[model samples]
Target: MDSRDWGRFLLPYEQAVEELKVKFKTLRTEFKSRDEYTPIEFVTGRIKRISSILEKAKRLNVPMDKLETGIEDIAGIRIMCQFVQDIHRLSALIRARKDMVVVYEKDYITNNKESGYRSYHIIIEYPVQTSLGLKPVLAEIQMRTLAMNFWATIEHSLNYKFKEHLPSDIKVRLQNAAEAAYQLDQEMASIRDEIISAQQHFEDKTHLVSRVLNGIQDLYYYHRIREAAQFQLKFNELWETEDMWQLKELSQELQEALQRAKRSNS
Candidate 1:
């Protein structure tokens, strides 16, 4: 395809990647705000480069007209998780989503590749609205733990450098590294509950502090300077002591104070 045609073709894929990234990131934020243990650590996405797409199409004997349907990963989303089990959780979440429909899935984690590559790949059909109409695009979502991603990143660089014909010694080393990364993920899973508990505690405290501050701001806006200052001082004390219970109490009190101030003004 010419440069102009390539740009036109890639525009929708680019939009799909960006929109999916935002959706997944928003999911993380929602979980954090609710003080819930989220399996997803982060999300990233990209559109395959034109050159890379062409190379793959040529290798697979895909016609130019069939590129859109043939290239399942024209738009790719990578969801990184904290634990191996989290990968399954994220996949389930994706399956439950209404905006995208899972066309198929490959369980590479359960059945590792010969190269020792491990990840959960899901192909989904995502509908995007355009000036013409709603366009259903095929996108790939890969879920992996942090360790898996790290190992995969290095291996990908080497593969590119060697053009998929790595030296035998390097290939063995990469396989060993992949095994090590899997072991690391397993070790982390052993203490997953403890890690999740600590994270939830931190998120709860953050949410409480945020609510208290917002209430204090509302107090100040309503000409309740004295009450706002008093609550601010209390928040500082509780925050310094890391007293979540007292902070929760203070948040409730501030909310009440703000309501009373509003009522009095009315």
Candidate 2:
């Protein structure tokens, strides 16, 4: 096919990618507001690859118009996560969505690819409304861990750099890197509980800091300047600890002190 035919086939896919990006970004914001554990680091989309598209069209003797709808990955989304478990959660999230209907699924994470690629893929029929009308399009979604994504990305780049032919040494290195990525995921999963506990502690400490600052702001309008200065000094001293647990304990003490001061003034 010529350049114009390529453009014609790719334009709808590009639109689909843009639509998915906007939808996913909005979803992220909504999830954050609701305090949901959305582990999607990023969602990326692309049309079916140009080279693949051309090869398929030639083999099938199909026109661009017929090929566009026939190719499943003309529009695709890749969801990058931090853990293997998150990939399952993300798949559930997508499957549960009323707007996006799952058409097919391929669990490459469980089966794994011969090339050592590990990702969970789902193809969904996503309805998008345009100026013309509502159109149901096929969107391929891939969910994988950050480490997995890193390995896949590097492998793809190397393949492209070597013109789809890699030296034996490079291929071995790529395989080793993929193995390392798998090990990294397992290691991180092992510490998942500890990591989550630390995160919760940090979040609590952040909330305590905000509360302390607000209390200090309120005191400026009521408490004596000398008392407020003493309170500020004590908070600064606690802040210097730089330990979330310690800071949290100190914040509780400071809150009690402020309450006592308020009672004494009253």
Tell me, by lDDT, which candidate is best: 1
Task: For each candidate, give its TM-score against the true structure.
Answer: 0.88, 0.78
Tell me the tens digit of each residue's lDDT in model 1 across 126-182: 998888899999999999999889989999999999999999999999999999998
Q: What residue runs in model 1 are displaced by over 4 Å at the alpha carbon?
A: 223-226
Every candidate's CA RMSD = 2.3, 4.4
Deviation in Å, model 2, residue 252 alpha carbon: 8.4
Q: Residue 116 lDDT in model 2?
A: 80
Q: Whole-model lDDT, candidate 1?
A: 0.91
List ranges where model 2 is wrong by over 4 Å. Answer: 1-12, 48-52, 55-62, 214-231, 242-266
Model 2 Cα lDDT, one tens digit per residue, 26-96: 88778767855567778887777788777767877877667646677778888888788888887887889
Residue-pair clashes per candidate: 0, 0
